[model samples]
Target chain A: MKTLIIIRERDYVWLRTVFPDIHPLLFPICNKPFIEFLIDFSILSGSEAVRIVSDGSLIDVEEYCDNGSLWGTAISYSSIMSMDDQRAVIEKNRRFCSEEKILIISGLVFIQYDKLHDYKSLFASQPNGDLLVCNGGSLSLTGNPPKLQKNSAPLSLSLIALDSLDGYYRLCMEILGFASSPYVLPGYNNEAYCHIGRNVVISKSAEIRKPVMIGNNVQILEDSIIGPGSVIGSNVIIDRKSTVTESIVLANTYIGEQLEVQNKIAAGNMLIEPEGGICITMDDPHLLTGIKKSGSVRSLLRFLVHSFAALLLITLQLIPFLILSPILTIQGKWKKSKNIYYTGTAGETLTLTTTTIERRGFISSLAAALSLDRFTLLFSVLRGRLAVIGSSLELASDSNTTLHEVESWYHAGVFSYAEAEEWPVSGGDKAIVERYFSVHGNPFLDITMTIKAFFNRIHETNTP
Target chain B: MIFHVDGSTGKKLGIAALNGRLDAKNSSELLTSFERWQQQTNLIILDCSKLDLIDSSGLGAVVSCLRKAIEKNGDLKLANLSPKVAMVFELTKAKKLFSIFTDTGSALQSF
Candidate 1:
């Protein structure tokens, strides 16, 4: 079965006005994107394929769901005019619908469904018409129905128009206050009324009163209180001596020290009172601000310094780099490749040609020990395409995805900040420290970091 | 900000009528003077009815005064919190820590 999810731009216009940069699909009802609920409903209703049709850009949503393979379903996206009616939508997606049963889920609506019930069979057996309808959207059948008539009563589904900031706040409170989820929710089952994601640091003095959903990389500081009802998104920090009750704080937000957050939606620096649509972009960083990875200026500076240092090294080791290259190549121990890597926040992609001498024989071991494989990448610093000391340079592969997840320390560089700190680069704690310094550290600090990293690499190779 | 003590409620009660901005610059002064005010009496009423704006520092100082009064087993109550000041208190959850009244007279009378 195919599912057509239609959400017009007008449906989310009010939300955009209230909270700029918040994609309606990414709006959190309980630390879960509002669209996830719709997706869950489509999957439950036996959708083999789901296509999201929106007039607005679906890049953020697409980036998030990414073909829906995680849920074992095929997800595709399309764009349509905001004025496109039901028939026009069907006509446009008729190619996808083909001969299969198509379920058209329309509007930016919240559907209240029971997880235990067999909605798949119920939907399949229903007549060839609209199965359920509500104010926000409707669930309708677009193909032939099964032969048998299912003896099921019409389910009760209501559309709560999530148009205002107050309405959004009220919706969150209402959902949290409810005993059982009216819809299927993800995460652990035994933990009641909360779905906290990975890598959350809650200080011992911090108090959690339950019925809260906290996302990944969140820091609930000392003497702070969370919940009774709260939904905190990823990469958020609730600083010390503060309290948050009955509110939804979105991703990449920094809640400043000792401030109170009650009954509102805080996305980045903007505090939104959803009902009246009263939004204030806080000028005070101590109250609230946005959290982002460090920019390329630091990386570029490091690159320049490293390049000059690399030039000095090349001039000094010119005979060695030259003499070693032929011997290692002839012995089949030297390998070379070129790949594209993100240089910095400028979003410039650069192709770097690099050579790695295999770490086997005595000469190769000496080269590796002396960090000779990094020889060519150091020249990339001269080209202003790589950083000397910052984040580890990311290869455009699966590793890059993992690096992006770190939130704080994803800037790619030749020499990692973790290496400079002599901290194990793989762990979360080290990543936190490295990321903190990357954004906050100075150029003089970078020089020290690079020197430390160079010596640390020497130490690492000496040990093995 | 102007502050005067009402003595009719069997105890000296300081009514600090805050006006305009009470931010970082003035917050420390408010906190420092709170010590002298405590010497006069423990019962206090911050009449925020005239307060127009408050930042984190101002909120912190008010919370600190409440803590000091509570430690002495006396009390600090708020009266006639304007919509904006009430918002600051509500956001910080400071409203939960104090007894709020509609007017200074009622706060003093209750004490």
Candidate 2:
């Protein structure tokens, strides 16, 4: 049997609104990513291959679950339009679903099944129909059973709808409360109801209760109470005297000293009460904050490389800007406007003098080609106020929206990643492209993107 | 901020409607203004319906106001806290220090 998992964007939109940084498929459940559990189940249910299709961007998930070598299953990913029905989805992957019996898992759901169950034989005997059903999703089989050896037995499987934060919290707590967990969870489990990961430094003074799962590279500081029920993700630090019962501390988070963190989801600086789905991004670092992995030796090297590139561009553009800017000004072709934009710092704005060099005569086209309009911004790049290639500047008028969006690796730049890709400047896709490059970009890619952006600007200016 | 007296409940309840943000830039203003509002009637209702955001300092100012009201034998209550702002209070454990209501009218009645 082969498996096809089709999760639509609408099914996981709530996860996007709450946890924007994490893909819904990669959202952790019982210390394992939600997708991994599904994969594990698929492996058990006599599946040799699995295909995951979604309407949203699956690049991150693809990066994570690449070719499914870890599971020893051939896994592939595809994108579908939001309006596509199950029939359309099946039709799209006709070749994969044609030869063998297909086990279709639709929507955002968690399947509850025992690891010890003989699911391979169970699936072979089951008829071509929905094996398990819920409001959120269904597990349906297509094509014929493996053989006609008449078999009748009750199937022990249920679907848990991960529709709301409350549902998610309940599901996690239930998994933790189980005497023996149904699914294979990560970390080292020496005893029941307790799992700890690598490089975990637990203070001798700290008290750890039963029913807890701690991820890799975590530090439980002095006098801390870790659990009666708690799930701590990788690179987390539970500070001194803090009580963390019935809570989940997501990866790369710092819980401050003497704080009570009962029954909440702490992701970075955000503290969310899962029951009510209310969340807050704390500004004060002393209380709760993200332990960012940037500012490393690599980033410092990238900054130096960017500064060198900026200095070269300044040297190249200084002459053209001096020669043509005055000529354009004389002919009233150079238009200048002062706009306030959000700076790198929170609650700070920088006044930038933007220019529009109108195309008219030879000098005008020359000025646009040489990118004299961006001459002043190069200095800002050198001064470390902006990057050579990063996100497009967000206006101060839009600071309210920027305040929310600027949380994840946002930095203003002279040239945007959107320009390198030649995407339309005004759309959601542009932000995606810019953010992708900002987080994933290195000095080498930045140089290539900078060159691409420069020539793209020239091509755009010289179009008409 | 708009300060008014609601006496329909047979008590002088000062209702102050906070607007925009209450961060470090403007938190001190709230603290300075609360002193005058307390002189009129210490039993005050901070209507946070229009308020959008608050930082740690802003939270400090509100807590300070509550303390000042308690010292004067009067009480300060918060009402209509937006979910965003209320989450900050919940995270900081400051929710236990205030009598919070769902609406300004309920806060007035409580006073």
Best by DockQ: 2
- Model 2: runs farther than 4 Å from truth? A149-151, A199-204, A280-286, A289-302, A319-335, A340-351, A358-369, A383-442, A445-464, B1-111
Q: Would candidate 2 be rated incorrect, acceptable, medium or high by CAPRI criteria?
A: acceptable
lDDT of 1 by residue, B1-111 (tens): 677888786677888887777788889888888888888778889888877778778888888989999999878899998765666666667778889998888888888
Count backbone overlaps in model 1.
7
Instruction: Tell me the tens digit of each residue's lDDT in model 2 across A1-464.
Output: 89999999899888888887788899998778999999999999989999999998887788899999989999998888999998999999988888898999999999998998988888887888878889889999886666764347678889998899889888888898783367899999999999999999999999999899999999999999999899999999999988898998999999987778888999899888888877888877878999975477886888899999999999999888888889899999888888886656354667999788888888888888888888888888877788888878778775366553535556788888888899877678987897788667899899999999899888775421
lDDT (0-100) at residue A81 of candidate 2?
A: 95
List-wise, what DockQ does each model earn? Answer: 0.30, 0.37
Tens digits of per-residue lDDT, candidate 1, A93-151, equal 87987798888888777777766667787777777677667666777888766778774
Local distance difference test, each candidate: 0.76, 0.87
lDDT score of residue A13 within candidate 1: 75
